[model samples]
Target chain A: MSGPIDFYFDFASPYGYFAAGAIDALGARYQRTVNWHAIVLDANFQSLERIRIPSSVMRSDYIRRDVERVASFMKLPYKAPSSLGLHTELAARLFYWFNDRDPQQSRAFAQAVFKAYFVEDRNIAQLEVLQQLCCPLQMTPDDVASVAGDSATRARLKAEIDMAEARGVFGSPFFIVEGERFWGNDRLPLLERWLDAGTY
Target chain B: MSGPIDFYFDFASPYGYFAAGAIDALGARYQRTVNWHAIVLDANFQSLERIRIPSSVMRSDYIRRDVERVASFMKLPYKAPSSLGLHTELAARLFYWFNDRDPQQSRAFAQAVFKAYFVEDRNIAQLEVLQQLCCPLQMTPDDVASVAGDSATRARLKAEIDMAEARGVFGSPFFIVEGERFWGNDRLPLLERWLDAGTY
Candidate 1:
């Protein structure tokens, strides 16, 4: 039996963006299908009382260092997000909506949003920017807006966050292969090794 | 001025115990003092929602494999902790008390504790085991208990935890050399290199 790899992601997280692209490559290389579970990280943080405190100067610095470390390792161009934080809930839900229709399109949408914020330093919170992001994916701005406004989609997003919390998921770019959750993107190589072993 | 290495630690963390011993050796090797800060990991989990779950069945299966990988890489024993979970708050505070009295004694105590829990499979939570552990050091059981119970020590412990939370300490065995926090015991050599560079 081939064990499936579940990719949990949030577009706002640079790590998530990195994992989305890399996991896709890994899936192709290993002949494994990645089941994408797009999740809103903000809601998860709020539910866990994991607030982003403004006074946490060291906290921000650590994130900067981590981003640099990961980017350097991955050979990806990364600058700390210019906006304080991306409103990931809307973006994740939109990805989920698109994934339901076309998974490849969802991947493109995730990448575009990441590039919009990380590469271009654009404010993703602005609706116009999000609408503009959808154009590249051939997803109508109205359709994207419509999906973003769906109460059911929002509820599904919440369910995704709840499921992650229930499963003891603590961080983004979490990979669950055969019910085992690897919390960090750095563990992807380890996850791949496990897949190759064919033990589980 | 040689700035102190802010040692971020969680009392209940075994890796913290490992780092504590190695940090002392590193300090002696480099002629520096490590400013140890006791941080409550439970508080970090609450704030960050990063809870430690056991490795997956497959991941667990891969433990022996990875242990060998890490052991060969670091040239250190990579045994898993005996007890599934340990309460480190009291042990941490006791460590502070011991350190305040004598650094040598504290280092011995830390090493003993690590060996007991990680190597010998002893339950560190049991007072009887702790008393036996303390006996070799000639630490009066009553005095040790009193120190563990001191309100001032408890308050100081909480304050230190608060400081760690503010400083963005996410995991155990975190070392800060010249204001840089390096997470994980594996990062100690890298920390030593940075210290040698003497760039603050």
Candidate 2:
């Protein structure tokens, strides 16, 4: 049996959403398990001395165009969110809580959240918006609130970020299979090749 | 006639070396001329407020691994240069001088330089190393010296860097095919797809 693919992403990243949609099928094809971990990467950016300014003109424009083009090529549905820079703490905490109990349901929850944010252009920053996401997953408002506000869940997510940084994860949609790290969705092909061939 | 593909690179960038090897063929496939431009991207990095620490551990390690893996996957020979951060201005100037005379020879010169610096791990920063490279293209030592020390050649290379920055080029291995910008060697597939489909 192949090793599990450790997939790390920040909840607010569109690239992460895109990778989530594809990584599982990729893992299954290679006889590997895909493990998704939601992490707050603001600290990673801070370490790199990067400022998260929304309108950094040229880069922002290129990223928007790139994401759209990638979605088109992959045939994944995407729409630019109504407002940018929505905080993702609530959504991440809820994910961790679900993942702690039922890993399969948590993956479903993650897909729904990505769909809501990227495809539906819904604001995921709000609890009510996340609460609506729970309905489709057959989860209750109580379950959503229970995890969303859980101190332990929040701490676990924080610890995950620290652990990711320690493991040298600096970008979204980052993957680690059998100790080799691959960054960016663009590297998916290379990652597939790595799995197809035992080694280079 | 199709618009030329503007290929931008920093001479010292490993990824640039890899792209330099592949881009002309890519251009030919689409019936487009590949115009190679070498730029000093320090100013762009400055604009992004980037710090140029030699030992940024993780990123540097990842880049080294990425370049080697990519080279192996592409069946291209590669070796990390003996030293990092070699200045590329002299090479860029000489390239422009040759390019002004014969574009085909200039492409050959660029490949030789990439091989010398990457495969042989030669110090491209040195005049003798560059002079030796000019020999393969049947260029005289005087020709190499003339371009290496020419004020006009220096100005041209500087102008190219400025032009690249104006065109929003912030990274090496950036490509503009028919005015659509593709950044990174990883995007080469998408670029190929765009060429094949005549726009996405």
Compute each candidate's TM-score over C-alphas: 0.67, 0.92
Candidate 2 lDDT over residue span B1-200, tens digit each: 36888999888877888899899889888888888888776533444312222334313677778778889888899987778668888988888988888988888888888888889999988899999999978878888888899899988887888787777676778898777888888888888888888785
In model 1, which regions exceed 4 Å deviation? A43-61, A150-170, A196-200, B1-6, B18-105, B118-128, B135-171, B184-200
Highest DockQ, which number? 2
lDDT of 1 by residue, B1-200 (tens): 45667777665565565576678678777778867665657543445423232323213433334444444344445466545457777776777777777877876787777677766778876766777788898988887788778997787777777677666566676776666767777566557766777632
| lDDT comparing candidate 2 with the true structure | 0.80
Candidate 1 CAPRI assessment class: incorrect
TM-score of chain A of 2: 0.90
Interface RMSD of 2: 5.7
Model 1 C-alpha lDDT per residue in residues A30-107, reported as the tens digit of each score: 788888887766564443423222323323656667566556556677777656456777787787788888988887
Candidate 2 regions with alpha-carbon error over 4 angstroms:
A43-59, B43-59
* Candidate closest to the true structure, highest lDDT: 2
**Which has the greatest TM-score?**
2
